[model samples]
Target: MRVFVAGATGVIGSRLVPLLLSTGHDVIGLARSQDAGAGLERLGADVVHADALDHAAMRHAVRVAAPDAVVHLLTAIPARIDPRRLSRDFAQTNRLRTQGTINLVDAAAQTGAKRVITLGSASVYEPNGPDPATEDVPFWHRPPKEFIPVLDALRELEALTAEAGGLVLRVGHLYGPGTIYARNGSFLHQVQSRNVPIVGQGTGTFSFTHIDDAARAIVAALETTADGALNVVDDEPAQVGEWLPVLADLLDVPPPVHIPVQMARSAFGSWGVAFMTELRGADNTNAKRVLDWSPKYPSWRQGFEAELAHPGSP
Candidate 1:
């Protein structure tokens, strides 16, 4: 199969191109810069220069690739977030999820692409529901003010993909070499410096995924005829109170301090407070069954120890 990938220079895309190539698939990556094009070339992927938001350019690029499958990985999320300015930070990413998806899906349809796969967020599920949210669970009915627009964008993204009979991989919090959870990434800096604190009971649950596993799942989805959505997460769902302290311990840093919910809201905004207190974890049963894929690091505990604690130690 000839695969066309948008956001080909991104964390997952960089890893995915090589995987697709190794599996004997011809990969064509959309790049916005010469540097990114060069990088994709080094990975043995053909490069097409086009911005995902530019409908004309994106359509032309996809048509030129004439791909059998299209994979959308476009996003502009920052390494570190400013809680107070959450909406501002996510504005571009929201655009990418909305318009970027439209452009790609439309192009795929034009070129008769058979399979279309795009990324989604597992965290969008309503937190008030079950402990482990499934694909059947609805998106948050009452999300935080900052997240309302984000969820709206996600809804648009998923709806568009589903209309095209494509698969939406709602990935969990990604942690690997290029993600914020990497050893030297911004998330670790926040942990090592004791910047992130536990809010209230810290009852919120988090489902995590290794970067390699995320790429593998995409590869699996390419061969499967499964449409609709799948929650691509790990086996274990951990609470904030449990994982934060464990991560601090692994990094030999001070445990996160606990603060009241009110203080947390003032410090980290409503979304931040809700994230630490009310967020629910996602279940990956559907994803595993649909794609016939399993995570390499089945738990964040093993992922953190291997990637964050002892990277390249052998």
Candidate 2:
């Protein structure tokens, strides 16, 4: 299969290009800069220099590539985030999820692409649920204001993808080399700096995925005819209190400090507190059954160790 990947130089796309090439797929990647284009060429992907936000250019590129499948991995998240500026920080990424997805999907459709796969976040699910969220669960009816754009963009992206018979992989909190959860990454720094504190009961559960596992799921999606949404998370869904100390241990850092719920809200805003105290985990059972995909790092516990062992891992 010939595949065109937007965000080809991104965290997941960088890993995915080599994997796709190894699997006998001809890959074409969108590159916005000369360096990115050169890097993709080095990795054996034919490079198309275009930004995902440029609809006309993307359509032209896709038409030129004439790929059998299109993959969207575009996002603009920074390596580090200040909790107080969550909404400001996510504005560009929100646009990428909503507008960038629209452009890519449209481009793919225009080019007669048969299949499309795009990334989605599991964090859009509602909070404090007893059961982990399956793909069928509804998004939060009233998400915090700061997260409204993020959720709205995801909804739009998913709707567009589903209408086009594309696959939307609702991935979990990603942790691995080049991800925020890496030893040298933002989350680790936050932990080391004591900015990521355990709040209240610290009961909000999160599903996690290693970068390699997430990329593998993308590879699996390419072959499967499964359309619409699938949750691509690991086996375990753990609470903040459960994972934080373990993460601290893996990084050889002190356990995260505890804060009262009110203090957390004041410090990190309501969204941050909600994420720590109420967000639900994702269930990946359907992905495993339908895509025949299983996570290489089935749990963050083992994933963390592997991440730390890798030299200069993100």
Best by lDDT: 1
Report every candidate's CA lDDT: 0.92, 0.87
Write the residue-wise lDDT of candidate 1 on 135-209 in tens digits: 999999998899888999999999999999999999999988888888878988998889999999889899998
Give the RMSD in angstroms, all C-alphas superposed, for model 1: 1.1
Cα lDDT tens digits, model 2, 96-181, are: 88878888889888889999999998877877677999888899999778888778888998998998899999999988667888
Candidate number achieving the greatest TM-score relative to the actual structure: 1
Candidate 2's TM-score reads 0.97
Against the hidden true structure, what lDDT does model 2 obtain?
0.87
Local lDDT at 115 for model 2: 98
Each prediction's TM-score against the native?
A: 0.98, 0.97
